[model samples]
Target chain A: MIDTVAGLAADPSGSTAQDVVLRAENVHVEYDGERPTRAVRGVSFELRRGEVLGIAGESGCGKSTLAYAVTRMMKPPAQLTGGSVVFRDREGRETDLLALEGEELRAFRWNRLSMVFQSAMNALNPVTTVGRQFDDIYGAHRPEMTKSERAERTKALLEMVGIDAGRADGYPHELSGGMRQRVVIAMALALEPDVVIMDEPTTALDVVVQREILDEIERLREELGFSVIFITHDLGLLLEISDRLAVMYAGEIVEYAPAERLTDARHPYTQGLLRSFPDLVGERRELRGIPGSPPDLRGEVVGCAFADRCEYAFEPCRAVTPHLLDIAREGAAGWRAACHLNDPEHRSSVSDAEGPQS
Target chain B: MTALEVRDLVVEYAQSRGKPFRAVEKLSFTLEAGRTLALVGESGSGKSSVLKALSRLVTPAGGQILLGGRDKVPAKEYRRAVQMVFQDPFASLNPSHSVDHHLRRPLLATGRARRGTEADTAVAELLRQVNLTPAADVARKRPHELSGGQRQRVAIARALAPAPDVLLADEPVSMLDVSIRLEILNLLDDLKRQRDLALLYVTHDLATARHFSSDIMVMYRGQVVERGPSDEVILNPKHPYTQLLAAAAPRTGATRAEVRAARQVRAAARSARDAERRETVVGDGCRFRPRCPFAMDVCATRPPEAALGGGHRVLCWLQSEGKAAA
Candidate 1:
């Protein structure tokens, strides 16, 4: 249960490098049209087995596009310009996701890499019963399984999400929003996929409902031992459930750290995002949101995408694009930030900054 | 000054079968000028129903909505004094229409501004107020051309075109980005203060509700479980449901044990929530009793309105029992 707040179970130092279930290296996705948009720009991350890696960013920050690209779910016009999405099986066989096509690609998804969309109602067929949906998955994947096995599996999955198995007979509209979301989750886990990519799965639900769903996801991830990539704009919520976080801005990861250390991030965008949410337990103070809008990525960006909004942006920030540099944070390996402030030459004492501490 | 007063407001929908569904049951509240009241609830909690009723989109089955301390007011007058900013800016705005037309129509319809330079200046001023600079550039652009944040600003601008005394914003920033959400909320807060508008903010997010609103009313299945000053209600909740909401909200720097404790209580409640559908008829009992951790025998019937001073009130049997002692 401590894993929900601080991951004692998901401590990566205990895990081996071989446990990397999925790795994306220098991933790039572009939407080619009249006005071309580079949705993802050289984003890279590793999803270790049994670890919850949260991709935190706002809308159109390319987090979703990155997810779709990594999973090889990109449709026409939106193509993966460059990247290697390597999926390493438990038996130590690496499969290139971008190379897989047709039957192999269709079989790969839900068998290994599954996705839970933002809206469950949209994901689920309104016309079909929830039980039939599970049966359909079983029919498609586990064709050798008996009818009774499929039925029993459906019952167990429904019960796993704390929903009554009897409700499987009901349509998506018959169940509540939370129940529908839970059903979608249950279906996603039907095949017991190695990695589940949930993109804002609980955004539309209420606070209580979202919390319950998150808790359930954490529980199921522990019980089943599967890695998860949870994406959301809610930095506060992400801080709670994630073992490690990747904060993205305008298609690039600005900061990567253990969930606990994100509040003390070196990136101005991450800090601004952390401050954006009003704490439910803290002293009430007025929050001044970050001013200015994100730069249009349709055209080439010369420097930092967040430079226009950064309070600490200086001369070098506008002229040069900051690369992701390793920062020092105790007990957290791979703590990095893409900011000029991370460099000593660019470091200057600001009223809010915690200057250069290893 | 009381800008709007609502007493025993009951909103019902005609069901195909059985009795009419009571979406809101005897809800009572007063909105003061230059103050924000947040109605916090999940789906089926009737926060939307209340918004619909307040905006005159749906007539209440019962109760009186007294604007400026009077129940009787002209329809045009009521409309001019009360305006709404919808949840989805994309759907709220017409795709074919420009930003100028949206703001201009409201101003002209309400007699806030006339056609020609008067209307043009009013539209530009409205756009400027929302921080959409070089007003002419933004005014000419259609809704599709603008970003989500900019479109929301235009929606706010459109809402302000009539210069209403009350602004009903329904999840105005939920659809927006994290960084942009605060910008819109801060803009709304500034506009509220500047215009001295009575703002009724309805949303599912507790953190924003507590921060943006002076008062908060936590609703559960068409009934308010708790109502109080924002900080008091969130910081030290008297009701079980409100307590759950406060604890369930994800916050930075939360202790593991605290989360574990919340999770343990949630196990039983999750099952209860799954088993129980939100029935139209709540039957003269505490609405939160189904999910309440500390539900007693008295909760089966009706709980007393236990007042915890400072305008904080709870409709829980536990509060009623511990009132004299605590």
Candidate 2:
């Protein structure tokens, strides 16, 4: 029902112009493959300007699919079946990202919405100089800017990413894996895009490099005021960087809340995810992994996507697909979850007085 | 005696010219029977090199690996004693071969399980140890047929097929998802405890290392920068690099603004010191000085003497008493 931009803002605190750069409503994506899978089912959220919105889930959870849908870059076999992605441009026009086609789609890319993929290093032209690649992207987007102007801008971008400007002239092969990823990020930001979708950008890099690259990206986002749709399997990283986070399970958002709430999550899926992660700063103990694997999205999914693995899954969970509903009526801040326990009417019948909260 | 003991372990990769590249520099640790010792480091820090050297996948340039206090000079016996579970399950297991084919071959090769009843029981036991249910069905399945977690279990089961005294897991769960990650870690922990098997876990994940191992060795560029009780090293880390690593662990509860601010400070600090830190540490001298925030004049030239006590060791000029050697 959250069809309009104002409807998205109505869910929480009044979203100002400075807030909510991208708002997705009831997004449902399906892969019309040989098996015709319903990959993402009724997913919705908002990415405020200058804020990082983290989408966290295990593989095949459709967090990456959600990111792809937002960028209007969903690959073949994967089709955007329903819903709309409303993104406000710097020019103050609300563009329905899903509606764009052909030339408009190409122009929208890198200029308004950019993406830094999981293996971003692989995206770079291995033979070309990093400087030239940056220039090419910059030149393509801003044809009026001269070569000298492009070069000057490229150096600044490289320096902004904490990479030495001199090394921009070096080929992708010459740069370290971390350095190349940073260059890719710099290229994504070349056009000063309003929204940047990163699909596990630093997943391949070592811990130190991962930290460094994420740090640079965080810095860049702050300086430029671009909304970031950061997707990753590591909930820890998302929890740290994201203002709000959406936990996906089998192509659906099982939990959606502010980043702080994720740690003390009410959703069973979120709790399971939290328990699974080995904490760096905590009592050293054996982590209890969620038993069973994620369900195959290729098959006919009835009821909840997580029913097969969920400890708290009941008859209702296996009977019907739970819609994203606000869990807490008063205490929580616009917290929504697709789990049955979070259903509004379900909460009304259960006496809060004797509930576990006490 | 400890199940596996790596004494002053040094491994150097042979280069085309000049001195061989020292991958592991004078590393030493022991895993008591039924305990896990996690060796943690970044890409070039020689974590995998140590594991490979132990399993004889790669030959050590110097030092010795002792199996039951005796040097494992003959590599075959060591391979039988210690089996490695590699990171990539898909690549490690043969796709063409069925699960039973992969499982039964190792048991037969090691002579731990003979054909017929004993071999079948052992295979079932191996599957049970890693929590792969319906053992009979799993035995016939191929590597591609199973999910990532199940594939990892098959790899672990295969390692156990030989009844190895020690398990060397090189980032086994890194490729798996977070939800499934803990299952693998728990399985390893259980296997170590139940069988009294020593485990040498190599990983870059400090959090997982802390969760699984009692003792931890933090390596930086082929040298052990810090080694001690996992809690002490991870929580109250004395080394500058360890401190940075602990700080870099993405905090869950922090707002985007706070996290972004901290990330900026860390990036600035890393950039400010990266180049000077790259210049090869002076041999027989403190290697951490260049990157150290509290580097002094003595750190530039003098090698900090080791301070070892209660299964803990730290090499830093600050920890040194500055007393002249006898």
Candidate 3:
């Protein structure tokens, strides 16, 4: 079904056809139990080489689960039920990430893809020195490398993140929260992967430290030329960093568009989210939060997941599900939204009854 | 009316092997009724300490906390007049207890209710005030049964149970989802207007502070570096720290080029000065001087406060001298 939506023209940023790095197609993940929850439902997106693609959503919206599933990191009780994750290497070799098993999966991970987990404090080993932790990653992957080579790489990685190499001998407890996060980033870059997935990497840090870490990541991405899949609940940060964004709501991608075009989003849910945040620089307007909680994923959703909270929800939104389709607009061609309001035939009828709520 | 006045307040934390660390140093601010004063800073910047001091969670090392211009107030009266809403709704609420029980305890303890029937009515009213509709149905649910936004509403309802004149919310909505945070903020704003309650909202995010509060104070380390009306302070920040914070907060309409420019400005500013690494300092000079982009020889000594009109004041040598010359 997504074949119609696939092979859309490259973004005007000059991303050629060969720049596609990772493509996730119709992926579904479910948390198995007595009443299983479908965490990620038919989510699909493609990431280009050296491009920053952001996944924005609230907590429990399955954004994080989708990130874990793409990296093949989902543990027991949470299993990927369907779809494929295809990764293209530097030499144009394609590998189905979900099909790999055992040692093949191990070799693919960290070499082609790496992830920086949320809460950087918990990501590091507290019992061992930071140097040893870096050594552990290199040892597992590059077993034949000499200890001196590992130490040299560790020192270089530390310096790259602006941490002194001398601090590598200290335990995780000795470093501040920001430094620990830098260490984790260094570890992720140890294998020099083609893509790095960071899940709320700076959520625990202060705003200043968060800015510093973000700056470092941007600098590293530019120099190292690795694509980034940054996931966070902060749409503000996403708009600043992401070249393209996919807004997730209740286990589904509601809107996919260029980051700059998000300000004029077509989806009501996306518009609501944009209006929900308080502005730092602009004139103050009364922030109207999207009322009501997200739908329970335990039960199957029939229509639009955001129907209850959306003021612009119409009849088709309650009876039939809308598929993600291209809704071309000036300066934002190839923009897709899973909303009936964008449908030409449906919009003509509904637009007369209701104006845009946002 | 001035609901609360904190004068030269100091908060200290005892270290395991060294002298007591001063978390908040001579911080002074006034909160007027029906208005909000936001204390904005990063983690470990003593914003939470001010809230803790107001709630009596931490004893002040020195200075007076006056109520309505009076230096002394009865202990029970003080506790009743000032209430606190914590950051984490999940941890602040009792998992096992129903929402009714949570609100009832505060009401009964404050002598707002006498019997079961009265307590029940008060609990229902509290829930209704926080906009948790169908109060009876929500009252029977446990904290675990509620969503993050609903749990926070219950926490706010419990805080209002004491009929407090002042509310201290320490990052009340930071742990909540992005979509739900504004609802809680709007709720607090509504309650402040309806009840004429003075609110002290503490958070690290400056954007939300400007949205919810009328007056804003930017803190660094343990001292107020700049303070003024929210719009004035945010729009025309006199202090470098305030400028950095404003630029660092991601804006919704900001383009990637603008963001990159802001980041470049922050990076240039950060690299201009050597950031101090020491945890504790004992100097009278500006604590932020180590990382200040405009640091001068005069910053090595203590700087006097400069009034910038419109109730905006900045503690910087350059500003003071500029004002003196003018």
For model 1, state the Cα shift of residue A185 in Å: 1.0
Best by DockQ: 3
lDDT of 2 by residue, B15-80 (tens): 999888898888887878888888888887888888888888787878878888898546667788
lDDT of 1 by residue, B19-116 (tens): 89889989999999999999998888899999999999999999999999999678899999999999998899999999999999999998988899
Measured by TM-score, how close is model 3 to the native structure?
A: 0.97
- Which CAPRI category fits model 3? medium
Q: Look at candidate 1 and tell me the lDDT of residue B112.
A: 89
What pairs collide in candidate 1?
none
Report the lDDT tens digits of candidate 2 across residue range A1-358: 3432244557665567556788888888999978878889777788787888889888888888888888887888889989888888666788888889988888889998889988866899888788888878866678889989988999998888878899888888887788778888988999898888998998888887888788777777767888899999888888887878889888878778788667767677788887777778877665687888777777878888788877666567787877776655454576777766666555455555533231
Q: Interface RMSD for each candidate model?
A: 1.6, 1.7, 1.4
Alpha-carbon deviation at B105 in model 1, angstroms: 1.3
Error of 2 at A4 (Å): 12
Give DockQ: model 2: 0.71
**Chain A fold similarity by TM-score, each prediction:** 0.93, 0.92, 0.96
The model with the greatest lDDT is 3
Q: Give me the displacement of residue B54 in model 2, in angstroms.
A: 0.7
TM-score of each: 0.94, 0.94, 0.97
The candidate 2 chain B region of ten consecutive residues with least summed lDDT is: B317-326
